[model samples]
Target: MHPSTLLQLALMGLFVASIPLTMVWLSADANKYRKLVWVMAFLTFDLIVFGGFTRLTDSGLGCPDWPGCYGAANPFIAHEQIAAAEALMPTGPVTKVKAWIEMIHRYLAMGIGVLIMALMFQSVRQWRKTHQQAFAPALPVALFLFVCVQGAFGAWTVTLKLQPVIVTIHLLLGMGLLAMLVWLGGREDYLLHPPAPSRDLAGLRALRTLALLAAIVVVLQIALGGWVSTNYATLACDEFPLCDGKFIPEMDFEHGFTLWRELGKTAAGHYLQFSALVAIHWVHRNFAMIVALVLGLAAWRAARQPALRKTAKLIAAVLLAQLFTGIATVFFDFPLAIAVLHNAGAALLVLLVTMLNYKVKHLLDVSQRTPANADLPANSYR
Candidate 1:
């Protein structure tokens, strides 16, 4: 990397780090490690949003490669190569805007990696002092490993030509990272305010089951959305509430749902047909309806529980936002803004679900509940 490029990378890294650092310093709980975790969690959410922007703006392939764009640390150094690629394919995915978007996403991701490293360091210090491993340093260690895997999939997302399955996994992994960080943050928050007793012992168990159901369905929806994007099928059906103006418009499920092949390719390896794209879009559209109903019902049930109302309402609100953004994407021809919001909404949903699951799980463990709220137990956040 050139001196200037390296300087840019360093400056960007510092700028990204500063956001959370300020939050940590200014928090009411300053000097508390939990504050640091909350800052990381907030920034993780921002990273998820920026990631959506990168994908929506067609920047996933902006660098034309991974880790470093065009074998350089920053786009400034790789400008010439990016220009050449764009010139060869004018409307292709490697323009200057896309490059910036991609690089910015990478920078944010790197910042997160650094923060998680800091978290691990803090956890190790705490664990050594306490000499107990209940809330072991291994939690941070696991997160570190997970993000590295996510970075690998991020690379493959570009290098492998955005293969649907890989891209889909990449999307899910990003969400997984956010959810994990949220859980870590939730642990800290829960530590401050003990865990509430399960509203109904059986209902509490059912909550876990409902959350799991929500997760599986959301994953399926996201995967379907990825398939739609990878195949360039956003406009496959212009009219929503119905596909191409019918209960079921023409489709090529065999081609659309064919799992193991390059992106934009049919099962047998030919260029994908429009109907196949329609099939992909259509399935995601319809499946979303079922997912929304299930999740809405789950959140409503959660709301009925005195301990879970606030989060349940939050989950419900985000789900509605997701539905709106999703419908807007189709009615509005998949504008970049709506598309990004849709992705962000999906990430938010995943995080909320994970927190709900984690919280309820702790409630089930009676010993860990907090003392301030004696009725509830403190989950071990050591």
Candidate 2:
């Protein structure tokens, strides 16, 4: 929290971000802008996965501070404080290992923030030089602002003692950042390789609707999944197909759905009951079925379109993987690796859905233009 500590953290973040920026500069690819966007997207995805790892390992409070470990820039410098905390509670959240995990997650997040800043800087410079709308600075600016907000939530996740709502929103914001980057990258790709004009307006409209619906379903499922994780409800049911070995198990939905409560407590500050945990897990479990059915239908419909077949395949594959990991978490009592992969799978699904949406929107844009340019050849739009 000190000024010097903040400066040190910022420098560390810049140093980590420089590695990828250096790679982007050295690459032979002509479209460095697109490459940088994609690289950021890739790193953002990794950050989300590492974040899951951090949460699953119970390292969120490893430092008991934000943006630094125990008011120190690095865990090494904060060793005395961390050791004292561990001495007080050896098996608690402030162990040396957990501090390192928490710091690493923060470092990655800061690195991403640096990259986004660089992106905004580059976008502005390019737009000024070229005066081209294609080189617009809007998205990079928006991303910079969004990452700032995400960073705030990240701090709150630690400072608020892992309040379920704050933590869930943190997770959702991270995925939302990834989704935005993927859309930006997809937009760059479309600019580089415009698709041929399409006459299938009706088909495009249908796929667009399905893709949008699928994206909505995925976001809701992710929110539910986040709630489950934040509330530590993964092992509440401890069985498959039926919760507590019954079709209608007793649950406390009123307490379970209390959005603003602290972790492990009801709205009225009472210790959360097992029934509430069961309710959280049960809703997430049942919703998975609905998400699967809806996304499966969307993927099938998408696969029927020749242009979107590959994206559709990816959606199907990720959906199946998600289902496996979801069930495996229950069957295996929520192993760390499997649980993290479940989070990664959710991020992947968001990426795929965003891609599908972009592709369908691209097609729809072409379709709308096709009628006006009907005198030209189909390939002329490209």
Candidate 3:
């Protein structure tokens, strides 16, 4: 948090951000804004995945400080402090490797922040030139603000000692950033190739609603998963189809669902009950059924529409992979690799569902705009 450390962090962010900025500048694509949007989207996705890796490794508090490592810019400078922490507790959170992992995650996040700032600037400049909706600066500006808030939560994750709610919200906000970026990219893609008039206006309208519902369900499932992870309840049950040898599995939802308590503690400052952990794991496990059903239905409906077949396939594939990873983590005792994949799968689902939503809305719009569709009945497309 010192001035020198702040300067070093700023330079690091700029250096990391310059890679994509340079790529966008030199690309053959005429719409550099779209290119930049997508590059940030990809980087944001990486950030989310790396974040999961950091958490899975119990490295969230590696640096034990925000924006820097032990008041230094990098782990090397803070080696003495980290070493002391590790020396005090050999297997604790502040080991040298963990400090590196946590700092790298922070560096990537800062780099993404710089890219979002660039996006907002580019959007404003482009809007001044063309005044097109695609280049509107509002969402970019909002992204800028949102990332700042997310960064705050990142700091709180460490300073508050990884309070479950704070960490969970931080993960959710990262996913929200990905959702916004994907939607923005989709907007640019739509502008580049507008949709053709749909032959089934009413069908698309219904599918749009379903896609939206799927997204909501996925988000909820993610929230539950985050709760389970942050609370270290992933192994509470240790069995798939049955939780602790019973479908119901004794659970304490009252303490488990308490929103604002510290990690592993009840609101009354008592240690959380084992049943509470069971409740956390149980709900996430069962709710996945709803997620599969809703996403499967959306994918099925979208697959029937030629324009959406590819995206539908991706949704279905990722869904299966996600479910498999989730179950594997249980059967395999939550290996780090599979656990990280489970998180990545969730992010991919968010991206795919957002894409589905965008395409359906576009198709519905195209159908409504056709002159021949004016006299069509409620269920008619032709």
Candidate 4:
């Protein structure tokens, strides 16, 4: 990529990011910082969904280069190169349409980077002006670093030729970034309006544990799903209730779980077998049941608490939708829209769990601080 191309892409990101920044500045809200963080979180969610679209459409290698399309800022500027590639392999990955999709995804990612930078800047300014530690600058600084790392993985996704591990980590890092932003936003909301004391402090603590466990299970399930997607194994089995119409089918776990191999080959460099793909799909399919059960139990427990009922309902609904979409992907042969929604559903679950975790923590803190609870032993809440 040329210096000129880098500058142009940076300028484009700035232009795109400015739209939301302008809205934040123009709003009458007292806390522009909080509003900006929430907006970034929303946009990050959008980026995750669009990224799934890019992957599902096989646009990951549309440019065959990093940070630019064929060493140019946009697809139009690299039309000649793209056209040549497409001409060489008309049905391959380098079509003009894919170039556009790939570039647009990059542009959105860069815009998010710019917004996070703005957040860091504002945090520093707020701390300096108010001399208050409440406006901590550490998280914004951490976010800046995380996004840089995420950007590096994005580049590797293209340069490494869609290596399964790199692509899957890229997906996980994007979701992790969203989780951090939601946690930050929730913190801001809590500081603005602290929650009331809870009568059942022990229950709240248990709920927090459950929510965290659910989040872990969801992350694992997502990793399995990513492996399936990156390895192009969605249709390996082609049956839902049982793989290949049997309770157990021939599988190659050793080959399937080889982490450092290329996209569709085992560590020994042999072409990945159908049994390996079946193993990949089968594990993801079975894990979905575990995730559904754990998340459902958490939702049922959470719904009994008035403060958490609404978010609990949301959790339950998304879990059901995820189940439907996960099965639909198999039954419908992985339609683009439903497949993308499956990814989005995973993101939504991450957000909800993070939010629930934050809320429970907040309630626990309130319970600890109340005068009525002062007489109780520290472990009494447990």
Candidate 5:
């Protein structure tokens, strides 16, 4: 009966529908595996960025309720209640505009969930007929489960009142989902047939490890970055290479690392001190240097690979974009566009590294003996 409640149900309905709609679109080429994977990959990236937009804009709690705006289908229907909340606390996070942003983020997430499910289903169907062990649907199934868990984190992210640890974990999980999807998509693209061992599998192995480490560094940086954003600590250090005009500003590690507290609280229920905010920002900034060095090395190695040259160059370009965005956030006072893109760049880096890893290592141990995958198969129809 409440407007906010209605809003939640409507959004859930839209989320459910996006799955079937994506399936319908893919029906045109039920066999275009690589193309479908790329399409879904792009959509997942969009979801990540839009999600960043939702959080950075302080709309994560736009409705202050799960699934909708005061039980209504749209903000318009809940305008009276939202306006009342805003009037009570002007400049708070519960305005109608924010509620819409958060709800839209949810809708987009659900859509991506549907697309992955479809990819998994199709992989199963194709694998059955072709006996292609590569696209056997295991990873997709795993990702389907992972997305369910990610949804739970999304709920907790709000229901837990945006606890820093919970929010940071939620951001990591979302990026994790993106990495999984990108890996699957890349595997689907590369493993039409089992790949022959590279002339130097050892080099590939080293690169794989390097890529994984590169991704790990980026994720940690991203988590720190998320902490900074979620707790409104971006401006804790306004200068480029220093905080409060000093390289090592005063910092409170105890409060900053107090994992179980809400957005701006200490473990003992006290308001968070400014030093803690400085610590969060400082750690993230420092990690950026390490990430840059590792990514630079990984990109250089990838560039040397004949097949991976383009992807390697992409890695370099994205790093440049990411670096520019990060600095811009500080010098430019964290403009919404740059902040959102900075987050998006991290997601992109994750996707690229995951895809690169998959291409190099997703070899299937297939003895299927199918004429399709033989020495000179009838066609590369897979």
Candidate 6:
């Protein structure tokens, strides 16, 4: 929290971000902005997955501080404090490894912030130079703002002692940021390779609606899953197909769904019951079926379309992998590797669904254009 510590953190972020910024500068891609967006999207995906690893490993409070480890720039500098904490409670949260894990996640997040700043700067500059709608700073600026909000949540996650609601919201915001980036990247993709006109207007409209709906469903399911994870309810049911060998076990929905409370505590500050954890886990487990159905239907519909066949195949593949990992995580007692992949699968689903939505929208736009407006530049529609 000291000024020097803050400066050191900032410098570290710049150092980490420079690698990707240099890649974008040196690349011969005709559109560096597009390349940067794609790269940013990729890193954001990694951050979200690593975030899951952090949470899963109980490393969220490893540092037990914000933006720095033990009020220092890195774990090395805070070694003494971390060691003392670990010695005091060997199996507790502030071990040296957890501190490193937490700091690494923070560093990666800070690096991402630097990249967004660069993106926003370039976007604003390009918009001023060309006055093109594609270069409009709105989305990039919004991304910048969203990342800021996400960072605030990150801070709260630690300072608030990993409150269930705060932690769950943190996870949701990270996913939301990835979705936004994917949508932005999809827009760039269309500009890079404009889709051809589609004769099937009704079909395109239906697919677009389905894709949008699928995205909404995925987001909600992710919220449920986040709640399950944050509440440490992954093993509450401990079995697949049926939870604890019952179709509907006893549950405490009122405490389980309470919005504002400390970790493992209900609104009344009493210890959360096992029934509440079962309720949280049970809801997420069952809701996976709904997510699978909707996304599967969307993928099925898209697979039949020549234009969306590739994206559709991706959605199907990731959806299957997501289901496998979700089940495997439970059957295998939430193995770290499988669990992280499950989280990664969710982020990938978001990316693919957003891409499908954009593709369908592009085709619909092409189909809707008439002779009078068909001549307008594609950027105009954007």
Clashes of each: 6, 0, 0, 0, 16, 0
Evaluated against the true structure, the overall lDDT of model 2 is 0.91
Candidate 3: where are CA atoms >4 Å away? 374-382
lDDT, residue 129, model 2? 99
TM-score of 3: 0.97
Candidate 1 lDDT score at position 65: 73
lDDT of 1 by residue, 173-278 (tens): 8878887878887777676677545425566677778888988898888888877877778899998788877988999999888878987786678998889888
Give, for candidate 4, the lowest lDDT window spanning 10 residues.
Answer: 373-382
**How would the candidate models be sorted by TM-score, starting from the highest?**
3, 2, 4, 6, 1, 5
- TM-score attained by model 2: 0.97
Tens digits of per-residue lDDT for model 4 on 188-270? 88888876666677777888899889989989998999999999999998877988889799999999989899988889888
Residue pairs with colliding backbones in model 1 are 368-378, 368-379, 369-377, 369-378, 370-377, 370-378
TM-score of 1: 0.88
lDDT by residue (tens digit), candidate 3, 1-382: 6798899999999999999999889999998889999999999999999999999999999999888999999999999999999999999988999999999999999999999999999899989999999999999999999999999999999999999999999999999999999999999998898866666776788899999999999999999999999999999999879998999999999999999999889999999999999999999999999999999999999988878889999999999999999999999999999999999999999999999999888778878778976555443321
Q: Candidate 6 lDDT, tens digit per residue, 1-382?
A: 7999999999999998999999999999978889999999999999999999999999999999998998999999999999999999999999999999999999999999999999999999999999986788999999999999999999999999999889989999998899889889988888777866655666678888899999999999999999999999999998888887899999999999998998989899999999999999999989999999999999998887777889999999999999999999999998999999999999999889988988888778876875544454432322
Using lDDT as the yardstick, the better of models 1 and 6 is: 6
Better candidate number, 3 or 5, judged by TM-score? 3
Query: In candidate 6, which residue pairs get closer than 3 Å at backbone N, Cα or C atoms, i.e. clash?
Result: none
Off by over 4 Å in 6: 372-382
Residue-level error in angstroms, candidate 3, position 381:
13
Cα deviation at 90, candidate 2, in Å, is: 1.3
Candidate 5 stretches with Cα past 4 Å from truth are 1-30, 125-130, 193-197, 363-382
Candidate 2, residues 1-382: lDDT per residue as tens digits? 7999999999999999999999999999999999999999999999999999999999999999888898899999999999999999999989999999999999999999999999999999999999766578998999999999999999899999999999999999999999999999988988888887766667778889989999999999999999999999999899898888897799999999999988899889999999999999999999998899989998998887777889999999999999999999999988888999999999999999999999999878976876565564423434
Each candidate: RMSD: 3.9, 1.9, 2.1, 2.6, 4.7, 3.2
